[model samples]
Target: MASHRRPTHSGLTHSARVTVLSAAAATAVAALGATPAGADPQTSPERARAAVDRLFQEAEKATERFNSASERATHLREELGQVQDGVARGQERINRLREALGSLAGAQYRSGGVDPTLSLLLSSDPDTFLAQAEMLNMVTERQHSALQDLQRAQRSIGQLRTEAARDLSDLERSRAAVARHKRTVERKLAQAQRLLNSLPSEERGAFDRASRSGRGVLPAVSGDAPASSRAAAAIRAARSAVGRPYVWGANGPSGFDCSGLVQWSYAQAGVGLPRTSQAQRYAGRQVPLSEARPGDLVTYRNDASHIGMYMGNGQVVHAPYPGASVRYDPVRMMPISAVTRV
Candidate 1:
């Protein structure tokens, strides 16, 4: 009867195979049950690094917004001050015009309500009175001019007052935005610090050492420095700040962000650059990376959140990130969006 044919495969009977499979499944379940804690070793560190990077990126975006709002508020304050001054001057001119008009009315009343010109024509000293009449004619012309000026000043004062009010309103809104951005940055940075603190001591040490290592040093000035005086000066200035701390919105000898470093370095060269990376990207003539010269700003990331000053020889000086200082990195540290010659 074909041995009631329980087929055999791999030299095992069907019953034997079934038993083996059951035992294997049970063993797998047991092994899974006995699995140790933290079986996957890579997850925590990877997640921590990714979280830190994400938080830092968010903080940077908020920092830029804060910087922009701060700059706008400053400009608005200056403009409002000028407008208020103009309004004060307009009021003064209006008062002067009123006083002149009053003087003219008083002279007419003193002339017995008759025309001053008629008084001049009937005077005994006719030639002398004629000279005085000429003077009076000049005064009359001046008074008419003052009246027109007064009307114009009044209109100007109205417009200036309106502008001043609008500027104040805008400034208040900008201040609110700045505050919001500041809060966002602080929260993100705090979260990042917490994530970083969670990293193992060895991993944290490695990360810190990496930041302090290779690329953070100043780049050597190559012989290929651009011939442009301003560009060379800017490059020199940027290089001089290689070890400065990174401070959001600072354009200074103390600390700087990416665009702040660029702006401040250019300022040292007597060149004016825009405040933010986005604006600075368009502030100068854009050039191809291959054609980039010393002092050209190399903007990174599609959003233009990062920038660095080209220091010739394929190196750039940049304020890399929060924990990193102003340093030299390869021009290809990140994706290059633009190279602008300021």
Candidate 2:
């Protein structure tokens, strides 16, 4: 944040909110993977402290992976630039050598130029003849050496040019891989930042208490989905707020993930619900697809991970992913398993 921000008792600063969020998200992910039940784990402050420490450990691991990816991208970019420069310089040297060789060959082949033997025979006196002959031989030797020098430079440049081109090709592939890795790291960091920002200062003590004991009492939303008018109004309102970014687990004016947005919409209609889709599925009355109506809880995917509200005409207003805008998409595209009218 650019405004007033302070460090927490855990030695975490608000400006590093992304790191904190990443830690919390990592905790949620691991729990989803290995936790047997979503039970209350908090018993004491000491225990909560231990839990937060564990969460922080998870955060560190995720951060390490992100940094590693970023470093790889930087390395690839640097290597590419170096190799490209080498290729260009080698090409320039090769052209210059070729040009010099062409001029020297033309001079050696010209009809106006005489052979060493002919030049010696054309001299007027014996002394002059011997001297001119020796000079002619030296000139011939010099021309031969110059042509050889040009050939050697051409050969050296050709070999270097080949190596440089190969290096450049390798660098291009590495750069593409690095770019993919960079996108992953940036997305993870941004998601973590969003979660930390969602958990404001007021919740810190409570979060700390929960973390000490490996428990967190996620605040429930306020509203009811079964109330038709209010629920319909809420859903319509949510639809109007489309085109916002899909920040995972977000519920809001700015953006939200699938479940978070649905939960928030119902909350506006006076329904109270948990934050996760798995919990959301169990919050409302189960209804068959044939009986499903607008403002009903619609869940998809095996883990009940994705949720959306049933809009009329068989569409859903939901957040899709990290880099997407929340909008209405076909409900049929989702892996729907059940429906609930809250």
Candidate 3:
């Protein structure tokens, strides 16, 4: 049976980064799946947009994770190298001790070069010879102690060798794991880059005009500061749970894991996204980022591994991982992946 595994948002799919043509193109409509025209489009579009931008941003964030893993792998390998060196040195000490013990046992002791039983029996003073025999017993005890120490050193060297071997195996696995993560991150970055590249330069003006249609006659992107709106308000609601801690598979206004928070936020906005980041990113519309809005979903890391909600101003609301709460972050920190306007 397969153990439930934690989802790792690392990189992207090979073809994830394709571009889009127009903001109102069929892809956008398909992604949104809700018209801004009637019947709760106003409420629903906000949710859809939030989901899309979150997917893109999460995909982009994979790159940061990939880089961090790479550095960690490198450090672990280095530490493993040092451990192996210690093992080697331990072996050398054992060998030297063994040699010293062997030589001492062979040359420093004999059945009795001077205090031989034959010599003792022939001695004129057997009493004095008995004292010398007692001294020989002391020498034998010292030799035994030295031999035991040599034996102990050999055992210790053997244990160190085994430990070093295990460390090397662990280090190799870590390095491979990091490589997989890098591949994931690259995939997301490529996807984000691809989506951004999809729109023609001429479409920029059209999106800018559309973005300005909201109430109060907002200024253009050139000098406009990001403003709060219903979408932003909804995102703020999502961000409120930051620091509440993540619990996988739990969706709560109190605390949430990554997908749970995303799922709950969309639920609040009156739309439903997939329960997982990968599935969520898969269902959204292929958007030219120029069409991205404050509430759009952003996915980051590879394979739509992690996700966040867009809050404009280059920020996101996401439950990053276990022990973490939903928080706002710069969208650039993530891959800026394809914006799926829900």
Q: Which parts of model 1 have CA positions greater than 4 angstroms off? A: 1-41, 110-142
Give the distance in Å from residue 312's predicted Cα in candidate 1 to where it truly belongs: 2.8
Deviation of model 1 at 342, angstroms: 1.5
How far is 139's C-alpha from truth in model 1 (Å)?
Answer: 5.8
Q: Candidate order by lDDT, highest to lowest?
A: 1, 2, 3
lDDT, candidate 2, equals: 0.57
State the lDDT at 179 in candidate 1. 92
List TM-score per model, in order: 0.79, 0.39, 0.44
> Residue by residue across 263-314, what tens digits does model 2's lDDT show?
6777777877766677788887898876777777778766565667777566
lDDT of 3 by residue, 75-142 (tens): 77787788778778877887877787777566645644454556667878978889967876776777
Q: 138-250, model 1: which lDDT tens digit per residue?
A: 98898788788878888888998899899999989998998998999888888767655644454555556555443346557777667489998888888888878878768
Q: Which model is ahead, 1 or 3, in terms of TM-score?
A: 1
Greater-lDDT candidate between 2 and 3: 2
Backbone N/Cα/C clashes per model: 0, 14, 48
